[model samples]
Target: MLSEKSEQFLMSLRLELLKRGKKEDEIEEVVDELRDHLHEAEQRGENVDDVTGGSVNHYIKTISKEMAFDKRIIKMVIGALFAIVAFFLIPRMVSGQLDLSMYRIIFYGLLTFVLLPLELWVLIEMLKKYGNSKKGYIAPILVALGGFLIILAGEFLLREYDGESVIVMEASTIFWLGVILSVVFILVCLYFYQWFYIGVLVYLVLPDLFANTMTDAAPGSKEYINVSTAITLILTVLALVGALAFYARYKKNS
Candidate 1:
C-alpha cells in the first residue's frame, strides 16, 4: 500500500507533468512507475523521501528541468502572475491611490516578486506534508492570511520609516477590491478544474462579505451587529465546509 503522503506527491507530480505538456500516455506510465516504487518502499518500511531521493519541490524542479520548455507551463505561470498582480493593483487603481514613484514601485515589487512566492512555497510544503489531515484543509487559508499580514507589516514599517511616502487605501476600496479578486480567483480555479482552490476563494471572500454586511448593518444597534456577525460567521463556515467536502470527494474519485 502506498502512504497518503506518497499518494499526494504523485498527484502533485501528475499536475506538474501535465502542466509541462507531457502526453497522457506518458504521464500515466510515469505515475504508474512511481506508484509501484513508492508502494514497494512502503512494504519494505522505507521512507518515501529517501526512496524518492528528495522532497516534492525537488521532484518538481528535476522534472521541469528534464522536460523541454513547455508553453503550457509558461501560460499557467503567466496566468498566475497576472492574477496576483491584478489582485493587488486593481483595487488601488480603482481607488486612485497607486503611487508610481520609483521607491514605492520598488517596495511593492519586492513584496510581490519575492516574498509572496516564498510564502506560497512554504504553504505548498506544508500542504504536501499534511494532505490527509485537517491542517491541509486549513493551511491554504493560513498561508493567504500570512501573506496579507506580511504586506500590512511591510506597509507599517515603511510608514514608520518614511511617513510621508507610504501607500494607503480606504477600507471601502479594499472591500470592493476583495470582491473583484474573489471573482478572479474563482474563475481561475474553474479554468484549472481544481477543487482545493475553492478554499482560497472562500478565504478571500470572507472579509469582504463581512465588511459589506457590517457596513450595511444599522449603527448603534447591538442586535444588528450581533446578527451581522452571526451571518458572516455562518456563511464563512459553510463556504469552508463546502470546499473541504468537495475536495474530499474529488480526492476519493481521483
Candidate 2:
C-alpha cells in the first residue's frame, strides 16, 4: 500500500487529467501505472515528493501534456446542454407556461455555454494549483457565490424585461413536450447511472407540483409562490445532504 500522501497525489493527478479532457481509459491506465510505481517507491522508503521531484503540480502538468484530449468531450457538452434545458423547461412546463423569448434564449445560452464552463475551468485550475488545502477552496467558493448572485440578478432582470415572446405553446402542447423531455431525461440519466441528477430533478420539480396541489391559495398568488418556493428549498437541501452522504459512503467503501 502507498502512503496517504502518495494516494492523494495519484487521485489529484487523475482529477487533473479528467479536467483536461483526457480519455478515461488512458487516465485509469496512467493511474494504475503510477500506483504500482508509488507502491514500489514506498517499499524502498521513498515518498511522493521524492518521486515527483518535490513538485507534484509540475509532474501532473508534464503528464497532462503527454495525453491527448478525449473526443467524447463533445458528447458530454451536448449532454450538458440537454440537461440544462430540461432542468429549466421542466419546471416551467409543470406550471403550464412555455414562453420563449429572444432575451431569455441569449441569456441562457451565455450562461450555459460560457459562464458555467468558465467556472468549472477556474475551479479545476484552482484544484491543480492548491491541491487539497482549505485556503484553495476559498477563492472557488467566492467565485461560485458571485456566479449565483449574477444568476439571481439576471433572473430578476428577465422577469422585468417585458419582451415579446418568440414562442408560446398551448397548455396541451406544453404538457406533452414536458412529458417527452422528462422521459428522455430519465432514460439518459438511468443509462449513465446519474441517480444524483435524477434526485435533483425530482426535488426541484415535484415540490412545486405538490405545493400547487396542496395549497389553497391562488396559483400565481404570493402565498402560493412562497409555499412552493419553501417546499422546493427544503427538498433541495435534503437532496444535497443525501447526495453528500451517498458520496461519503461510496468513497469509504471504495
Candidate 3:
C-alpha cells in the first residue's frame, strides 16, 4: 500500500495533468507506472519526497511538459459551457419568459467565459501546490469567496442598470427552449456519468419552477419572497452538501 503522502502526490499529479489537457489514457498509464514505482519504493522504506527528489511540483511540471495535449478536451470544454448556459437559462424559463438585456449578456459572458475559467485555473494551480495541507485550503477558499463577492456585486449592478433588451422570448418559446436545453444537459450528464450535475440541476432549476407553479402566493408578495428565499436556501444547502460528498467520493475513488 502506498503511504498517504504518496497517494496525495499521485492524485495532485493526475489533477495537474488533467488541467493541462493531457490525454486521459496516457495520464492513467503514467500514473499507474508511478504508482507501482512508488509502491516498490515505499516497500523499501522511501518516502514520496525521496521518489520525487524533494519537489513534487517540479516533478509534475516535468511530466506535464512531456505529455501531449488532448484535442478532445475542447469538446469537453464546449459541453461544460453548454451546461453553464443551461443552468442559467432554466431558472429564467421557469419564471415565465426569457428576457435578456444587453448588460446581462455582456456581464454573464465575461463571467462565464473569462472570469470563471480563470478562477478555476487559479484554484487548480493552488490545489496542486498546497492540496495536502489544511492551511493550503485557506488561500483557495478566500479566492473563491472573493470571486463570489465579485459575482454578487456584478449582479447587483446589473439589476440597477436598465439596459436594452437584446432578446425577449415569450413563455411558449422559452418553455420549449428550456425543455430542449434540459434534455441536452441531461444527456450530457448521463454521457459523462456525472450524476452530481443532475443533482445540481434539480436543486438549482427546480426550486424556482416549484415556487412559481406550485405555490399560491402572489409573485411580489412578502410571503412569496420568503418562500422563494427559503426554498432557494434549502436547495442551495443540499446542493453544497451533495457537491462536497460527491467530491469526497471522487477523491477517494481516484
Candidate 4:
C-alpha cells in the first residue's frame, strides 16, 4: 500500500543510486526503507498514494536494464558443472582396465579420487560464496592436477584393458602423459589454476616411472632417459610457475 508520490520518489532515487554504482543489496535496502515510510504515512489515513507523482514500476524497469552486467550466476553454474565432471571421472578410473601400468593407474586414480574431488568441493563452496572471488585459486590448482591425472588414467586404463606390460607400454605411456601433463599444467598455471599445478608437479615427478623406455627414443644410450626427463621436468615446471603466478594475481585482483 505505497502512496503514488512516495513510490515515484523512491523509483527516482533508485535510478540515481544505480548510476552511482550502488550495489544490489544497497538498492534493495533503500526500497524497503521507502516502503516502510509509505506504510507509516498511510497508517495515518492520508491518501499518500494520490499525493502527486505517477507510476513507479515503469521506472524500475528502465533501471533494470543497466545493471545486467553485474551477473555472478555464471561462475556458480561452472562450479556445478566442474563438480559433476569430477564425480563422473572418478568411477571410471577403477574400471577393469586400471592395472596395466599399475603406477599410472595409481597416479591418475589417486589424483582423480583425491585431488579432483577436492577441487569439486571447493568449487561448490566458492559458488555458494559468489560474492567472493578469492576462491578462484581452486580452479587453476585442480586444472594442473587434472592434466596429469587425465593422461595417466587414460594410458593405464587403455594399456591394462589390452593386457600389456612391456617396457614399450610403460615408455609410450610415460612420454605421452609427460607431454600432456606439462601442457595442462601450463594452462592451469595461466588460468583457473588451483588444481592445475598438480599436472605440472606430475610432469616433474613422473619420469622415473619408465626407466627402460627412454633409450629407445634416442637410439644412443646413457643420456637418453636422463635428457628426456630433464626436458619434460623443466618445461612443465616453468609452465606451472608462470601460469600459477598469473592465476594468483587474477585472484588477488578479483
**Which candidate number would show the highest TM-score if scored against the true structure?**
2
Tens-place lDDT per residue, model 4, 1-254, is: 66555654665555555444456685887577657866876788765444323344544454545444334445544554454343333222211111335455455465556765566555544433331244444655665676657767766666556444333434345445545544554464457644644553444344433333434443235565576567667777787898899999999999
Candidate 1 lDDT by residue in tens digits, 79-181: 6666666655543443324444555567678877788768867776676567758988898899989888988887776666643435566655654665676
Residue 129 miss distance in model 3 (angstroms)? 1.6
- Candidate 2, residues 61-86: lDDT per residue as tens digits? 76877788999888888887778777
* Cα lDDT of model 3 by residue, 1-254, tens digit: 88878877887888878887889999998899999989999999888887787665688766776788999999878878877777777867765556688788887888889988998888877776777778566868877898899989998887788487777667657756766676777787998887867876777766556666677665566766677788889988876897899899999999
Off by over 4 Å in 3: 1-12, 35-68, 171-180, 215-219, 233-254
- What are the runs in model 4 whose C-alpha is more than 4 Å off? 1-118, 130-225, 237-254
Clashes of each: 0, 0, 0, 27
Query: What is the C-alpha local distance difference test score of each model?
Result: 0.65, 0.78, 0.78, 0.51
* lDDT accuracy of residue 45 in candidate 2: 90
Preferred candidate (lDDT higher): 1 or 2: 2
Worst 10 residues of 4 by lDDT: 89-98
Candidate 2 TM-score, C-alpha based: 0.76
Residue 28 in model 4: lDDT: 82
- TM-score comparison, 1 vs 4, better candidate: 1
Whole-model lDDT, model 1: 0.65
> What is the Cα-based TM-score of model 1?
0.51
**Preferred candidate (TM-score higher): 1 or 2:** 2
